[model samples]
Target: MVTGQAVQLDSRSAWQRMRHWAFAHAVDDFYQGLVPASIPFFVLERDYSYVAASGLALAATLGSSLPQPILGVIADRWRMLWLAPAGLAVAGIGAGLAGLAPSYPLVWLLLLLSGIGIAAFHPAAGRDARRAAGDSATAMSLFAAGGSVGFFLAPAVATPALVSLGVGATALFIPPAVLMGFVLWRFQQRQSRNPVAAKHSGGRDRWVPFLVLTAVAVVRSVISGGIATFLALYWINHLGASQALGGAALTVFFVGGVAGTLTGGRLADRLGVLRTIQIGSVAAIPALVALRATPDPWLGLLAAAAVGVAMNIPFAVLVKLGQDYLPNRPGTAAGVTLGLAVSAGGAFVPILGILADHSGPQAVLTALCFVPLAAVALGLLLADPSAE
Candidate 1:
């Protein structure tokens, strides 16, 4: 039997809750890991051209992007209680089929399916998490931390699978998705049995914060995309760093993000959400600037960590902020935070890629620094829930 009425969790229980939450977040890694470990190898093994080989990842992102905002609205409106679970199931099934697909088009179709699966899960998962946390920063920290854990595990899970099953076959390893779905299904059933509480009013005026948050977050996302996409290349090309060291730098950044996110959430709860995001955004300015001028790999890695800490936390906080603004629209806020924020980064990819080509990654990153700085400015003016 499923249950609701807001899960009350202390630190220990919060961790336990997050374990389930993290399982849902891990869905990204399940497919993401395939890019390097399995998909590329499959291309080589199958003698597919570069264009054909790239379809899976490309199609997947596009597919996932399509439904998020719409689905988020649905989630906000109190429809599709089973959406998250069904989404995960779709992703898992898509992965399974992707492995078995014989042609490039088939792979594209499968990846699209997987993307839709991802799109389906995030809004509900995020909204549910926020509700469960009851505005506790620590609880939200636990919630956001699950994504990092998933990201951390992706390579570990997919790498071995790639070695054994080939890229396409590695999709079979995502067991957590199925289990999570079953559990979520149960929870939804319970949620249905008991009528939900009247949600907070999501109003037209909320657009002010929403737009500012989305705009600033997108800028941050661009900076992040620049770093994530090109940092290794930058290190190798400019600093003569080894590939391993570059990878380590990336890992350090992600670790920083995980730590920063948790810290940001806790701090936000205590200091106020806008204040926390403002501080994190300010903290990031120096980090991004330093990353470019520093010559040492160790220093670069340290800076990457700083970026991670600030980058990850702000969005999680923004989700919280969205919830604050749209008490009636947790699902919508969740969707914006998870789907739209990420998409913002994606939207910048082409332009940033062009900038990287014409100028260099440093220039792109330098340009990208303005995002969080803008966020800091916007955050300063933000009215809190108490103010409302």
Candidate 2:
């Protein structure tokens, strides 16, 4: 009876910690979303060209992507809980300051700094969050879903403010970062005082399967990045939809992503992680095909949502599986799956951009129809940790 009570109490405590990490993730990624959301305002207010605005995005992407793997190695070695809050604070301040910067270079640099903060936060947070999540894919899914929610909310939150107040309104987002950073700092301090042992199954690191999983993650990233980069254009240009309807389609896609992340985690609990990932990978091919073949923009909205859900159904599962495959290096695993490989997709977007330039957005979508087939092929090579 006493053991049962203690187990229940520990489970509740773990959940509470998981919630904190999830919230912090949302806040951190919100700054990421802010960059893209604010880009239009920069173009409008500063008369920046498409090239210059894209440069600003590239700045942030370079900062976030380059340092994460090294930082992940560092996190594994030192357990820098402070990085979570400090990074979060930097991300917010940098983004906030960008809106108020006088020169384009200054704004670009600030966005770069914001990206570094995001890079610094992930490996540390992933390491610690895994400690809290244990083997529950559902718990980790909540963390992943928080990011989706942040991205979904950014346009909604920043658009109205930027429309009314111009780019200066980005400064308004600074407070949440500051507040959340302090709260996370306190939360980490408390957890440190009562440190819990990390839960990792004793196993040898399986490099081959881990490599296969990374390939899968990269493919998934490319498909998702392609959709996100082009879906609105596809709606408006290809399907003859209004700008409002195009935006609505994009929103539906992101909302479906949030739902899919959560659903993946729950499915992982019931169906097992590798199986759930396989299902998602297989499902995405059909969803993307449907999106490509549909003639009506309204029908494409359903297909877009389906594509979003199917692609992300493996989102949280991939993070968890990467750790399981590399039990001795969870931080590094998370850094690669969450940061490096995901950013690799961004690199491909420029290629997609070139395609969009020549063949139209529908052609880009048609190309993406073939991308997830690679993910499915790679997924078949992934060994289930439990089965191993």
The number of the candidate with the highest TM-score is 2
Model 1 agreement with the true structure over 106-132: per-residue lDDT tens digits:
877877887788788888888777766
Model 2 agreement with the true structure over 81-166: per-residue lDDT tens digits: 78889999999999989999999989989999998998888888887777778777888898888888876677667767887898
Compared to the true structure, candidate 2 yields what TM-score? 0.89
Error of 2 at 331 (Å): 1.0
| Candidate 2 backbone collisions, by pair | none
lDDT assessment of candidate 2: 0.81
List candidate 2 stretches off by more than 4 Å. 1-9, 13-17, 40-55, 100-104, 197-201, 236-244
Worst 10 residues of 2 by lDDT: 1-10
